[model samples]
Target: MTIQSAFAGIMEAIRPLYDAREASNIAHLVMEHVTGLGKLDRIIHKDGDLPPAQEALYQQALQSLLELRPVQHITGKSWFYGMELTVSEQVLIPRPETEELVEWILLDHPTQPAWRLLDIGTGSGCIPIALKKQWPAADIWAMDVSTSALAVATRNAGIQHTPVRFVHQDVLSPDASKVLPSLNIIVSNPPYIRESERTGMQQQVQAFEPGIALFVPDNDPLLFYRRIAALAKEKLEPGGKLYFEINEALGQEVVALLVKEGFEDVRLKQDMFGKDRMVRCTKKEAAPADTTSPS
Candidate 1:
Protein backbone atom coordinates (compact mmCIF):
# COMPACT_ATOMS: atom_id res chain seq x y z
CA MET A 1 0.00 0.00 0.00
CA THR A 2 1.04 3.57 -0.52
CA ILE A 3 2.13 5.76 2.41
CA GLN A 4 -1.16 7.61 2.03
CA SER A 5 -3.10 4.32 2.28
CA ALA A 6 -1.27 3.33 5.48
CA PHE A 7 -1.98 6.74 6.98
CA ALA A 8 -5.64 6.44 5.95
CA GLY A 9 -5.84 3.08 7.76
CA ILE A 10 -4.34 4.61 10.88
CA MET A 11 -6.73 7.55 10.80
CA GLU A 12 -9.76 5.31 10.28
CA ALA A 13 -8.65 3.03 13.14
CA ILE A 14 -8.17 5.93 15.55
CA ARG A 15 -11.15 8.09 14.49
CA PRO A 16 -13.40 6.59 17.15
CA LEU A 17 -10.97 7.47 19.91
CA TYR A 18 -9.38 10.78 18.89
CA ASP A 19 -10.66 13.89 17.17
CA ALA A 20 -10.10 14.30 13.42
CA ARG A 21 -7.07 16.60 13.68
CA GLU A 22 -5.52 14.60 16.50
CA ALA A 23 -6.02 11.33 14.66
CA SER A 24 -4.23 12.76 11.65
CA ASN A 25 -1.41 13.97 13.86
CA ILE A 26 -0.97 10.59 15.54
CA ALA A 27 -1.01 8.89 12.16
CA HIS A 28 1.68 11.26 10.92
CA LEU A 29 3.87 10.69 13.94
CA VAL A 30 3.60 6.94 13.64
CA MET A 31 4.43 7.18 9.94
CA GLU A 32 7.41 9.38 10.74
CA HIS A 33 8.69 6.85 13.21
CA VAL A 34 8.18 3.91 10.93
CA THR A 35 9.60 5.45 7.81
CA GLY A 36 12.28 7.64 9.40
CA LEU A 37 10.96 10.53 7.36
CA GLY A 38 10.95 14.20 8.27
CA LYS A 39 7.71 16.17 8.15
CA LEU A 40 8.52 17.84 4.85
CA ASP A 41 9.52 14.55 3.29
CA ARG A 42 6.32 12.89 4.40
CA ILE A 43 4.27 15.73 2.97
CA ILE A 44 6.24 15.79 -0.26
CA HIS A 45 6.11 12.03 -0.69
CA LYS A 46 2.56 11.41 0.42
CA ASP A 47 1.89 9.44 -2.75
CA GLY A 48 4.97 7.25 -2.41
CA ASP A 49 4.48 3.56 -1.61
CA LEU A 50 5.51 2.36 1.84
CA PRO A 51 7.87 -0.60 1.93
CA PRO A 52 6.18 -3.82 3.09
CA ALA A 53 8.16 -3.84 6.35
CA GLN A 54 7.33 -0.22 7.08
CA GLU A 55 3.66 -0.83 6.37
CA ALA A 56 3.62 -3.86 8.69
CA LEU A 57 5.20 -1.83 11.50
CA TYR A 58 2.67 0.96 10.99
CA GLN A 59 -0.15 -1.59 11.13
CA GLN A 60 1.15 -2.94 14.44
CA ALA A 61 1.42 0.57 15.85
CA LEU A 62 -2.12 1.35 14.65
CA GLN A 63 -3.44 -1.72 16.45
CA SER A 64 -1.74 -0.66 19.64
CA LEU A 65 -3.16 2.83 19.28
CA LEU A 66 -6.62 1.41 18.71
CA GLU A 67 -6.30 -0.37 22.03
CA LEU A 68 -5.55 3.05 23.62
CA ARG A 69 -1.89 2.48 24.31
CA PRO A 70 0.08 5.72 24.45
CA VAL A 71 2.25 6.58 21.44
CA GLN A 72 5.24 6.96 23.72
CA HIS A 73 4.79 3.40 24.92
CA ILE A 74 4.39 2.03 21.42
CA THR A 75 7.51 3.92 20.43
CA GLY A 76 9.33 2.75 23.56
CA LYS A 77 10.74 6.22 24.11
CA SER A 78 9.83 9.78 25.09
CA TRP A 79 11.42 13.21 24.81
CA PHE A 80 11.95 15.29 27.92
CA TYR A 81 14.04 18.45 28.13
CA GLY A 82 15.39 17.80 24.61
CA MET A 83 16.66 14.37 25.68
CA GLU A 84 15.22 11.12 24.39
CA LEU A 85 14.52 8.76 27.24
CA THR A 86 13.47 5.14 27.00
CA VAL A 87 10.21 4.19 28.71
CA SER A 88 8.24 1.06 29.45
CA GLU A 89 4.96 0.01 31.04
CA GLN A 90 6.99 -0.17 34.26
CA VAL A 91 7.43 3.62 34.23
CA LEU A 92 4.96 6.44 33.86
CA ILE A 93 5.55 8.38 30.66
CA PRO A 94 7.23 11.66 31.48
CA ARG A 95 4.77 14.55 31.13
CA PRO A 96 5.37 18.13 30.05
CA GLU A 97 4.32 19.48 33.44
CA THR A 98 7.25 17.68 35.06
CA GLU A 99 9.52 19.53 32.66
CA GLU A 100 8.22 22.75 34.19
CA LEU A 101 9.23 21.46 37.61
CA VAL A 102 12.77 20.78 36.37
CA GLU A 103 12.90 24.19 34.72
CA TRP A 104 11.80 25.85 37.95
CA ILE A 105 14.64 24.19 39.84
CA LEU A 106 17.18 25.16 37.20
CA LEU A 107 15.87 28.72 36.98
CA ASP A 108 16.06 29.14 40.73
CA HIS A 109 19.62 27.89 41.14
CA PRO A 110 21.47 28.90 37.96
CA THR A 111 24.44 30.56 39.64
CA GLN A 112 25.03 28.12 42.47
CA PRO A 113 28.57 26.81 42.18
CA ALA A 114 27.32 23.41 43.26
CA TRP A 115 24.42 21.88 45.15
CA ARG A 116 22.89 18.52 46.01
CA LEU A 117 19.50 17.45 44.65
CA LEU A 118 17.28 14.53 45.48
CA ASP A 119 14.31 13.41 43.36
CA ILE A 120 11.90 11.21 45.24
CA GLY A 121 9.92 8.53 43.39
CA THR A 122 11.85 9.41 40.30
CA GLY A 123 10.17 7.05 37.84
CA SER A 124 12.00 7.62 34.58
CA GLY A 125 14.72 9.58 36.37
CA CYS A 126 13.68 12.49 34.12
CA ILE A 127 13.83 15.12 36.86
CA PRO A 128 17.37 14.38 37.99
CA ILE A 129 18.61 13.58 34.48
CA ALA A 130 17.28 16.88 33.17
CA LEU A 131 18.60 18.75 36.18
CA LYS A 132 22.02 17.15 35.87
CA LYS A 133 22.13 18.41 32.31
CA GLN A 134 21.39 21.96 33.45
CA TRP A 135 23.45 21.92 36.65
CA PRO A 136 26.41 19.80 35.58
CA ALA A 137 28.38 20.52 38.73
CA ALA A 138 25.60 19.54 41.15
CA ASP A 139 25.34 16.16 42.84
CA ILE A 140 22.10 14.41 41.83
CA TRP A 141 20.28 11.43 43.29
CA ALA A 142 17.00 9.70 42.39
CA MET A 143 14.99 7.15 44.35
CA ASP A 144 12.18 4.84 43.25
CA VAL A 145 10.62 1.69 44.63
CA SER A 146 9.91 -0.22 41.44
CA THR A 147 12.87 -2.24 40.22
CA SER A 148 11.45 -2.43 36.68
CA ALA A 149 10.97 1.32 36.62
CA LEU A 150 14.49 1.84 37.87
CA ALA A 151 15.84 -0.35 35.07
CA VAL A 152 14.25 1.88 32.45
CA ALA A 153 15.41 4.96 34.34
CA THR A 154 18.95 3.61 34.53
CA ARG A 155 19.04 3.02 30.78
CA ASN A 156 17.74 6.55 30.22
CA ALA A 157 20.42 8.02 32.47
CA GLY A 158 23.09 6.30 30.39
CA ILE A 159 21.47 7.42 27.14
CA GLN A 160 21.33 11.01 28.33
CA HIS A 161 24.91 10.74 29.60
CA THR A 162 23.80 12.26 32.90
CA PRO A 163 25.20 10.64 36.03
CA VAL A 164 22.51 10.32 38.70
CA ARG A 165 22.62 8.18 41.83
CA PHE A 166 19.62 5.84 41.56
CA VAL A 167 18.49 4.34 44.85
CA HIS A 168 16.00 1.53 45.29
CA GLN A 169 13.89 2.28 48.31
CA ASP A 170 10.28 3.06 49.09
CA VAL A 171 10.11 6.64 50.29
CA LEU A 172 7.01 5.83 52.40
CA SER A 173 8.30 2.91 54.44
CA PRO A 174 8.79 3.38 58.19
CA ASP A 175 12.40 2.22 57.89
CA ALA A 176 13.15 4.27 54.77
CA SER A 177 15.56 6.58 56.56
CA LYS A 178 18.65 4.50 55.74
CA VAL A 179 18.21 5.36 52.04
CA LEU A 180 17.54 9.03 52.73
CA PRO A 181 20.18 11.73 52.38
CA SER A 182 20.19 15.39 53.28
CA LEU A 183 20.38 17.67 50.27
CA ASN A 184 20.17 21.28 49.15
CA ILE A 185 17.07 20.60 47.02
CA ILE A 186 14.36 17.94 47.03
CA VAL A 187 11.89 17.52 44.17
CA SER A 188 9.19 14.97 43.55
CA ASN A 189 6.42 14.26 41.06
CA PRO A 190 5.04 11.31 42.92
CA PRO A 191 1.76 9.43 42.54
CA TYR A 192 -0.90 11.97 43.47
CA ILE A 193 -3.97 10.87 41.51
CA ARG A 194 -6.59 9.40 43.83
CA GLU A 195 -8.12 6.00 43.22
CA SER A 196 -11.47 7.75 42.88
CA GLU A 197 -10.10 9.74 39.97
CA ARG A 198 -9.13 6.61 38.06
CA THR A 199 -12.54 6.18 36.49
CA GLY A 200 -12.32 9.67 35.02
CA MET A 201 -8.86 9.24 33.55
CA GLN A 202 -8.21 8.14 29.98
CA GLN A 203 -8.22 4.41 29.44
CA GLN A 204 -4.80 4.68 27.85
CA VAL A 205 -3.43 5.84 31.17
CA GLN A 206 -5.51 3.59 33.43
CA ALA A 207 -4.80 0.40 31.50
CA PHE A 208 -1.22 0.76 30.31
CA GLU A 209 0.67 2.81 32.90
CA PRO A 210 1.96 1.44 36.21
CA GLY A 211 -0.65 2.02 38.93
CA ILE A 212 1.88 2.51 41.75
CA ALA A 213 3.40 5.38 39.80
CA LEU A 214 0.08 7.13 39.27
CA PHE A 215 -2.26 6.76 42.26
CA VAL A 216 -2.98 7.11 45.95
CA PRO A 217 -5.97 6.38 48.17
CA ASP A 218 -8.72 8.94 47.86
CA ASN A 219 -9.12 9.09 51.64
CA ASP A 220 -5.48 10.09 51.94
CA PRO A 221 -4.64 12.02 48.81
CA LEU A 222 -1.62 13.66 50.39
CA LEU A 223 0.02 10.31 51.21
CA PHE A 224 3.22 10.82 49.28
CA TYR A 225 3.36 14.57 49.84
CA ARG A 226 3.07 14.25 53.60
CA ARG A 227 5.71 11.55 53.80
CA ILE A 228 8.09 13.36 51.49
CA ALA A 229 7.55 16.64 53.31
CA ALA A 230 8.18 15.05 56.70
CA LEU A 231 11.31 13.45 55.27
CA ALA A 232 12.35 16.82 53.87
CA LYS A 233 11.97 18.37 57.29
CA GLU A 234 14.57 15.88 58.44
CA LYS A 235 16.78 15.83 55.33
CA LEU A 236 16.66 19.26 53.70
CA GLU A 237 19.45 21.61 54.62
CA PRO A 238 18.53 24.95 56.17
CA GLY A 239 17.24 27.29 53.45
CA GLY A 240 17.04 24.37 50.96
CA LYS A 241 14.09 24.03 48.61
CA LEU A 242 11.36 21.42 48.31
CA TYR A 243 9.37 21.17 45.10
CA PHE A 244 6.41 19.06 44.08
CA GLU A 245 4.33 18.54 40.94
CA ILE A 246 0.97 18.19 42.66
CA ASN A 247 -2.57 17.25 41.85
CA GLU A 248 -4.29 20.55 41.13
CA ALA A 249 -7.03 19.82 43.64
CA LEU A 250 -4.63 19.36 46.54
CA GLY A 251 -2.47 22.45 46.02
CA GLN A 252 -3.63 24.25 49.14
CA GLU A 253 -3.58 21.06 51.21
CA VAL A 254 0.03 20.45 50.18
CA VAL A 255 1.01 24.00 50.99
CA ALA A 256 -0.65 23.66 54.37
CA LEU A 257 1.25 20.45 55.08
CA LEU A 258 4.53 22.17 54.17
CA VAL A 259 3.71 25.05 56.50
CA LYS A 260 2.85 22.56 59.26
CA GLU A 261 6.26 21.01 58.68
CA GLY A 262 7.74 24.49 59.23
CA PHE A 263 8.77 25.16 55.62
CA GLU A 264 9.18 28.84 54.85
CA ASP A 265 8.34 30.88 51.74
CA VAL A 266 5.79 28.35 50.57
CA ARG A 267 4.30 29.03 47.15
CA LEU A 268 1.52 27.43 45.15
CA LYS A 269 1.84 27.84 41.41
CA GLN A 270 -0.31 26.85 38.43
CA ASP A 271 0.61 25.08 35.23
CA MET A 272 -0.19 26.27 31.70
CA PHE A 273 -3.83 25.28 32.24
CA GLY A 274 -3.97 27.52 35.34
CA LYS A 275 -4.47 24.51 37.56
CA ASP A 276 -2.51 24.51 40.81
CA ARG A 277 -0.11 21.74 39.79
CA MET A 278 3.07 22.84 41.55
CA VAL A 279 4.09 23.80 45.09
CA ARG A 280 7.50 24.89 46.37
CA CYS A 281 8.90 25.93 49.73
CA THR A 282 12.11 26.76 51.51
CA LYS A 283 13.44 25.11 54.67
CA LYS A 284 13.28 27.55 57.54
CA GLU A 285 16.64 28.92 58.67
CA ALA A 286 17.91 27.60 61.98
CA ALA A 287 17.20 29.85 64.94
CA PRO A 288 20.29 31.39 66.53
CA ALA A 289 21.25 30.58 70.13
CA ASP A 290 20.93 33.38 72.68
CA THR A 291 24.28 34.84 73.74
CA THR A 292 23.04 35.25 77.32
CA SER A 293 22.73 31.45 77.63
CA PRO A 294 26.53 31.00 77.51
CA SER A 295 27.96 29.42 80.70
Candidate 2:
Protein backbone atom coordinates (compact mmCIF):
# COMPACT_ATOMS: atom_id res chain seq x y z
CA MET A 1 0.00 0.00 0.00
CA THR A 2 1.10 3.55 -0.65
CA ILE A 3 1.79 5.97 2.21
CA GLN A 4 -1.44 7.88 1.61
CA SER A 5 -3.45 4.66 1.43
CA ALA A 6 -2.08 3.32 4.71
CA PHE A 7 -2.61 6.64 6.48
CA ALA A 8 -6.16 6.93 5.20
CA GLY A 9 -6.88 3.32 6.13
CA ILE A 10 -5.69 3.78 9.70
CA MET A 11 -7.72 6.97 10.11
CA GLU A 12 -10.84 5.25 8.80
CA ALA A 13 -10.38 2.26 11.12
CA ILE A 14 -10.05 4.39 14.26
CA ARG A 15 -12.76 6.95 13.46
CA PRO A 16 -15.29 5.05 15.56
CA LEU A 17 -13.07 5.54 18.59
CA TYR A 18 -11.86 9.08 17.97
CA ASP A 19 -13.16 12.26 16.38
CA ALA A 20 -12.00 13.46 12.97
CA ARG A 21 -9.07 15.59 14.18
CA GLU A 22 -7.95 13.07 16.79
CA ALA A 23 -8.23 10.24 14.27
CA SER A 24 -6.07 12.17 11.86
CA ASN A 25 -3.56 12.91 14.61
CA ILE A 26 -3.34 9.27 15.59
CA ALA A 27 -2.88 8.30 11.96
CA HIS A 28 -0.15 10.86 11.58
CA LEU A 29 1.61 9.57 14.68
CA VAL A 30 1.46 5.99 13.44
CA MET A 31 2.60 6.93 9.95
CA GLU A 32 5.50 8.94 11.27
CA HIS A 33 6.54 6.19 13.63
CA VAL A 34 6.36 3.48 10.99
CA THR A 35 7.70 5.45 8.03
CA GLY A 36 9.83 8.13 9.77
CA LEU A 37 8.16 10.73 7.59
CA GLY A 38 7.20 14.19 8.72
CA LYS A 39 3.64 15.29 8.01
CA LEU A 40 4.64 17.52 5.12
CA ASP A 41 7.00 14.86 3.85
CA ARG A 42 4.24 12.28 4.08
CA ILE A 43 2.01 14.60 2.07
CA ILE A 44 4.74 15.18 -0.49
CA HIS A 45 5.37 11.44 -0.75
CA LYS A 46 1.75 10.40 -0.43
CA ASP A 47 1.82 8.12 -3.41
CA GLY A 48 5.13 6.50 -2.54
CA ASP A 49 4.85 2.75 -1.91
CA LEU A 50 5.44 1.47 1.63
CA PRO A 51 8.24 -1.06 1.97
CA PRO A 52 6.99 -4.57 2.75
CA ALA A 53 8.31 -4.45 6.32
CA GLN A 54 6.87 -0.95 6.83
CA GLU A 55 3.51 -2.12 5.52
CA ALA A 56 3.48 -5.00 7.99
CA LEU A 57 4.23 -2.69 10.90
CA TYR A 58 1.50 -0.34 9.75
CA GLN A 59 -0.98 -3.20 9.74
CA GLN A 60 -0.08 -4.17 13.30
CA ALA A 61 -0.39 -0.59 14.52
CA LEU A 62 -3.70 -0.09 12.76
CA GLN A 63 -5.07 -3.23 14.40
CA SER A 64 -4.00 -1.98 17.83
CA LEU A 65 -5.60 1.42 17.18
CA LEU A 66 -8.87 -0.21 16.19
CA GLU A 67 -8.81 -2.15 19.45
CA LEU A 68 -8.85 1.20 21.29
CA ARG A 69 -5.17 1.22 22.16
CA PRO A 70 -3.54 4.57 22.77
CA VAL A 71 -1.20 5.64 19.98
CA GLN A 72 1.66 6.08 22.48
CA HIS A 73 1.14 2.48 23.59
CA ILE A 74 1.05 1.32 20.00
CA THR A 75 4.35 3.13 19.39
CA GLY A 76 5.74 1.95 22.79
CA LYS A 77 6.87 5.51 23.46
CA SER A 78 5.74 9.02 24.39
CA TRP A 79 7.25 12.48 24.18
CA PHE A 80 7.21 14.57 27.35
CA TYR A 81 9.15 17.70 28.13
CA GLY A 82 11.00 17.32 24.79
CA MET A 83 12.22 13.83 25.60
CA GLU A 84 10.97 10.51 24.22
CA LEU A 85 10.26 7.93 26.93
CA THR A 86 9.20 4.30 26.61
CA VAL A 87 5.63 3.58 27.74
CA SER A 88 3.37 0.56 28.11
CA GLU A 89 0.27 -0.62 29.91
CA GLN A 90 2.45 -0.89 33.01
CA VAL A 91 2.62 2.89 33.35
CA LEU A 92 0.45 5.88 32.66
CA ILE A 93 1.60 7.70 29.53
CA PRO A 94 3.06 11.03 30.58
CA ARG A 95 0.72 13.92 29.79
CA PRO A 96 1.40 17.43 28.49
CA GLU A 97 0.13 19.00 31.70
CA THR A 98 2.90 17.25 33.56
CA GLU A 99 5.38 18.87 31.21
CA GLU A 100 4.01 22.24 32.19
CA LEU A 101 4.56 21.28 35.82
CA VAL A 102 8.17 20.48 35.01
CA GLU A 103 8.57 23.80 33.25
CA TRP A 104 7.17 25.58 36.29
CA ILE A 105 9.72 23.92 38.52
CA LEU A 106 12.54 24.88 36.21
CA LEU A 107 11.35 28.45 36.08
CA ASP A 108 11.25 28.67 39.86
CA HIS A 109 14.69 27.22 40.52
CA PRO A 110 16.89 28.17 37.62
CA THR A 111 19.84 29.30 39.72
CA GLN A 112 19.73 26.92 42.65
CA PRO A 113 23.27 25.68 43.29
CA ALA A 114 21.97 22.18 43.97
CA TRP A 115 18.55 20.54 44.08
CA ARG A 116 17.55 17.45 46.01
CA LEU A 117 14.28 16.44 44.34
CA LEU A 118 11.90 13.52 44.58
CA ASP A 119 8.99 12.62 42.32
CA ILE A 120 6.38 10.51 44.09
CA GLY A 121 4.52 7.94 42.01
CA THR A 122 6.85 8.52 39.14
CA GLY A 123 5.18 6.24 36.61
CA SER A 124 7.23 6.95 33.50
CA GLY A 125 9.93 8.89 35.46
CA CYS A 126 9.17 11.75 33.05
CA ILE A 127 9.14 14.55 35.59
CA PRO A 128 12.32 13.68 37.44
CA ILE A 129 14.19 12.64 34.33
CA ALA A 130 13.29 15.84 32.51
CA LEU A 131 14.25 17.85 35.56
CA LYS A 132 17.56 16.00 35.79
CA LYS A 133 18.27 16.77 32.15
CA GLN A 134 17.87 20.46 32.82
CA TRP A 135 19.38 20.44 36.29
CA PRO A 136 22.28 18.04 35.86
CA ALA A 137 23.72 19.03 39.18
CA ALA A 138 20.49 18.14 40.98
CA ASP A 139 20.12 15.04 43.09
CA ILE A 140 16.96 13.44 41.76
CA TRP A 141 14.90 10.48 42.99
CA ALA A 142 11.59 8.89 41.88
CA MET A 143 9.25 6.50 43.63
CA ASP A 144 6.41 4.29 42.42
CA VAL A 145 4.31 1.48 43.87
CA SER A 146 4.51 -0.87 40.90
CA THR A 147 7.63 -2.89 40.11
CA SER A 148 6.67 -3.04 36.47
CA ALA A 149 6.18 0.71 36.35
CA LEU A 150 9.55 1.21 38.04
CA ALA A 151 11.19 -1.06 35.45
CA VAL A 152 9.75 0.98 32.59
CA ALA A 153 10.81 4.17 34.35
CA THR A 154 14.31 2.76 34.94
CA ARG A 155 14.72 1.93 31.29
CA ASN A 156 13.59 5.40 30.23
CA ALA A 157 16.03 6.98 32.67
CA GLY A 158 18.82 4.84 31.26
CA ILE A 159 17.85 5.56 27.67
CA GLN A 160 17.62 9.24 28.38
CA HIS A 161 20.79 9.16 30.54
CA THR A 162 19.15 11.18 33.30
CA PRO A 163 20.46 9.17 36.31
CA VAL A 164 17.29 9.28 38.45
CA ARG A 165 17.04 7.19 41.61
CA PHE A 166 13.96 4.92 41.54
CA VAL A 167 12.37 3.56 44.69
CA HIS A 168 9.79 0.80 44.87
CA GLN A 169 7.41 1.90 47.61
CA ASP A 170 3.75 2.64 47.89
CA VAL A 171 3.14 6.30 48.60
CA LEU A 172 0.18 5.35 50.78
CA SER A 173 2.27 3.20 53.09
CA PRO A 174 3.58 4.89 56.23
CA ASP A 175 7.13 3.78 55.45
CA ALA A 176 7.01 5.45 52.02
CA SER A 177 8.47 8.62 53.47
CA LYS A 178 11.12 6.81 55.50
CA VAL A 179 13.38 5.94 52.61
CA LEU A 180 13.77 9.44 51.26
CA PRO A 181 16.40 12.04 52.16
CA SER A 182 15.28 15.54 53.00
CA LEU A 183 14.41 17.09 49.67
CA ASN A 184 14.43 20.58 48.20
CA ILE A 185 11.46 19.73 46.01
CA ILE A 186 8.77 17.06 45.91
CA VAL A 187 6.41 16.54 42.97
CA SER A 188 3.79 14.07 41.86
CA ASN A 189 1.21 13.42 39.15
CA PRO A 190 -0.52 10.79 41.16
CA PRO A 191 -3.71 8.79 40.58
CA TYR A 192 -6.28 11.49 41.22
CA ILE A 193 -9.19 10.37 39.05
CA ARG A 194 -12.03 8.91 41.11
CA GLU A 195 -13.39 5.50 40.25
CA SER A 196 -16.67 7.09 39.17
CA GLU A 197 -14.80 9.14 36.58
CA ARG A 198 -13.74 6.00 34.77
CA THR A 199 -16.94 5.82 32.68
CA GLY A 200 -16.41 9.35 31.45
CA MET A 201 -12.89 8.73 30.18
CA GLN A 202 -12.01 7.67 26.64
CA GLN A 203 -12.15 3.96 25.95
CA GLN A 204 -8.46 3.73 25.15
CA VAL A 205 -7.55 5.21 28.53
CA GLN A 206 -10.05 3.19 30.57
CA ALA A 207 -9.38 -0.05 28.70
CA PHE A 208 -5.66 -0.02 27.99
CA GLU A 209 -4.04 2.06 30.70
CA PRO A 210 -3.21 0.58 34.08
CA GLY A 211 -5.87 1.31 36.68
CA ILE A 212 -3.46 1.43 39.65
CA ALA A 213 -1.80 4.46 38.11
CA LEU A 214 -4.96 6.34 37.18
CA PHE A 215 -7.50 6.09 39.99
CA VAL A 216 -8.33 7.01 43.57
CA PRO A 217 -11.37 5.97 45.59
CA ASP A 218 -14.48 7.96 44.74
CA ASN A 219 -14.89 8.83 48.42
CA ASP A 220 -11.31 10.04 48.57
CA PRO A 221 -10.24 11.55 45.28
CA LEU A 222 -7.41 13.42 46.97
CA LEU A 223 -5.98 10.25 48.46
CA PHE A 224 -2.57 10.53 46.83
CA TYR A 225 -2.35 14.26 47.33
CA ARG A 226 -3.06 13.99 51.04
CA ARG A 227 -0.57 11.19 51.52
CA ILE A 228 2.13 12.85 49.47
CA ALA A 229 1.62 16.12 51.27
CA ALA A 230 1.95 14.41 54.65
CA LEU A 231 5.15 12.77 53.48
CA ALA A 232 6.45 16.07 52.18
CA LYS A 233 5.87 17.66 55.56
CA GLU A 234 8.26 15.12 56.98
CA LYS A 235 10.74 14.87 54.10
CA LEU A 236 11.03 18.35 52.64
CA GLU A 237 13.67 20.78 53.82
CA PRO A 238 12.63 24.09 55.30
CA GLY A 239 11.46 26.38 52.48
CA GLY A 240 11.28 23.40 50.09
CA LYS A 241 8.61 23.26 47.44
CA LEU A 242 5.87 20.73 46.64
CA TYR A 243 4.19 20.45 43.27
CA PHE A 244 1.28 18.43 41.95
CA GLU A 245 -0.53 17.91 38.69
CA ILE A 246 -4.04 17.76 40.05
CA ASN A 247 -7.50 16.84 38.83
CA GLU A 248 -9.08 20.02 37.50
CA ALA A 249 -12.32 19.56 39.38
CA LEU A 250 -10.56 19.21 42.73
CA GLY A 251 -8.23 22.19 42.46
CA GLN A 252 -9.77 24.10 45.35
CA GLU A 253 -9.90 21.07 47.57
CA VAL A 254 -6.24 20.32 46.91
CA VAL A 255 -5.26 23.90 47.62
CA ALA A 256 -7.18 23.79 50.89
CA LEU A 257 -5.56 20.50 51.87
CA LEU A 258 -2.09 21.86 51.19
CA VAL A 259 -2.75 25.04 53.09
CA LYS A 260 -4.17 23.18 56.07
CA GLU A 261 -1.12 20.94 55.98
CA GLY A 262 0.93 24.10 56.69
CA PHE A 263 2.21 24.73 53.20
CA GLU A 264 2.61 28.42 52.27
CA ASP A 265 2.48 30.37 49.03
CA VAL A 266 0.07 27.83 47.62
CA ARG A 267 -0.77 28.53 44.01
CA LEU A 268 -3.06 26.64 41.67
CA LYS A 269 -2.27 27.31 38.03
CA GLN A 270 -4.06 26.32 34.85
CA ASP A 271 -2.53 24.53 31.94
CA MET A 272 -2.55 25.85 28.38
CA PHE A 273 -6.15 24.63 28.13
CA GLY A 274 -7.11 26.75 31.17
CA LYS A 275 -7.85 23.80 33.38
CA ASP A 276 -6.69 24.15 36.99
CA ARG A 277 -4.25 21.24 36.71
CA MET A 278 -0.96 22.24 38.33
CA VAL A 279 -0.18 23.44 41.87
CA ARG A 280 2.95 24.60 43.72
CA CYS A 281 3.48 25.60 47.32
CA THR A 282 6.38 26.20 49.64
CA LYS A 283 7.10 24.39 52.88
CA LYS A 284 7.09 26.85 55.76
CA GLU A 285 10.52 27.66 57.15
CA ALA A 286 11.16 26.71 60.73
CA ALA A 287 10.77 29.41 63.37
CA PRO A 288 14.07 30.78 64.66
CA ALA A 289 15.24 30.11 68.19
CA ASP A 290 15.06 32.94 70.75
CA THR A 291 18.49 34.61 71.25
CA THR A 292 17.85 36.89 74.23
CA SER A 293 19.58 35.58 77.40
CA PRO A 294 17.00 37.14 79.81
CA SER A 295 13.28 37.26 79.19
RMSD of each: 1.6, 1.6
Among residues 3 or more apart in sequence or in different chains, the pairs in candidate 1 whose N, CA or C atoms overlap within 3 Å are none
TM-score of each: 0.95, 0.95
lDDT of each: 0.89, 0.91
- Top candidate on lDDT is 2
Top-TM-score candidate index = 1
Residues 140-164 of candidate 2: C-alpha lDDT, one tens digit per residue: 9999999999999999999998899
TM-score of 1: 0.95
Judge candidate 1 at residue 292 and give its lDDT. 97
* Candidate 1: worst-modelled 10 consecutive residues by lDDT: 174-183
